[model samples]
Target: MTTATPYDAMFSGVIGQDYEMLKLLAPLAVEMSRLVGATVSQHPKTDDKPLSVVELGGGTGITTLSILAATDAIQLLSVDNEPVMQGQAQKKLQAWQAQGKLAFCLDDALSALQQLANGSVDVVASAYTLHNFTNGYRQQVISEIFRVLKPAGQFVNGDRYALDDIDQHTRTTQTEVGRYFRILTAANKLDLLEHWMVHLFSDESENHIMRESLALQQLAAAGFAGIHLSNRSEVNALVTAYKPR
Candidate 1:
């Protein structure tokens, strides 16, 4: 029998039903579609074919459904390692799958991306997922995203970023914790709040999110141009970057 890692164990039942967390993807979907549309418009070859998009860590299909509703895309491949999460997404995206507009792959995001041909994808997007990777592994994932993207292809990601200053990071984390605590308490969901608190304080290296500046720097090093923070609230941010044409 295999034992679950701390990360897997923590997220096993908690991630899929977190409606508050999932709702953030709605606005992120709009922003991501806009960036994709803007980028495809700039490149005529992309306009000639249907846009191919890959979404990493597609939990519960919230982001996928939001994107599908907000954008017109030829193909979308949603990749995730968790079977339960994938099942949720698959159920939600069945109509799109039947229409050849969406598909779900049961695989790790990095492994799935590595299997794709270089410069084949038009866009890659993710929400609240990549932050689970350590800075080093996250950089590797960014590099793979860079490799797989066609020239001028875009990557839009919505996730938490570490603050550059220690004090600010602490304050931001504290504020977020307080906000969640109050909300959960008001909703009489102390059990859920406890689960979140435990995960928040977990000492896993993979839980360490990179600062926005460092993340942008990594994207630049991976040969992405036009990197920018498109949206932000407290520690969460939506960032967009492009592979140079």
Candidate 2:
């Protein structure tokens, strides 16, 4: 039997089945745009120019829409590797693309970020996406984000985190699973709920969420300054780090 990839097991068909679950990222995206705007305003060179924002793993474009609504004069690029997710976003964001406000790229996040020139972007954002990477690869991706950002640019991500304490991590994981159970149950989609329970609660290598402190440390090691946890719950968090001027 063929082994299931992370994308195949957890992410494939996610947009069609649980798009509402993805909308939870919208508030985080708004905060990311706010930080991006504030950071850009502090730099006179980029203040007047259109903000260049790159979103990694732009699933379904809900977060994209939130960012666009939160900021003005932005040139947004929504990049993802999944065709189905990109297709869903493209349909919703077509009007914005026609108006030169948005563009969708079907590409891997790391390669796309690497191809951009140094200091070419004002902000790099992602939601519930980076956790898909292992701890080591996630650090490399963070470093790449640091590389492409303009001076004083921000990297904002809202995603799940693991705790340092094993017991706490277990507890948090259980709570998160329970929360999802309630959500899926209330939606009256028990069939989908069963799939998600296995996908989320399973100890899969692809679901290796890093400890919040370690993630912050990785950002600092990548030369990001002003690292901050903007929001947090037991398992979910929004973190922001800045490229120093």
- For all predicted structures, in order, the TM-scores are 0.83, 0.82
**Residue 171, model 1: Cα distance from true site in angstroms:** 1.5
Model 1 misplaced stretches (Cα beyond 4 Å): 1-10, 17-45, 202-207
Q: Tens digit of lDDT per residue, candidate 2, span 213-242?
A: 888898999999988885565666678788
Across residues 1-245, which tens digit of lDDT does each residue of candidate 1 receive?
12453342345665445644524423443454344345433433456567788989877776777667656656889998888677877877899899998888888888999999999998888877787776777888999999999998888887766667768878978877787777778877776676677666652243455677888899999999988895576666778888998
How many collisions per candidate? 0, 0
Q: Please, what is the whole-model Cα lDDT of each candidate in the order they appear?
A: 0.73, 0.72
**Candidate 1 vs. true structure, TM-score:** 0.83
Scored by TM-score, the top model is 1
Find the 10 residues in a row with the least total lDDT in model 1. 1-10
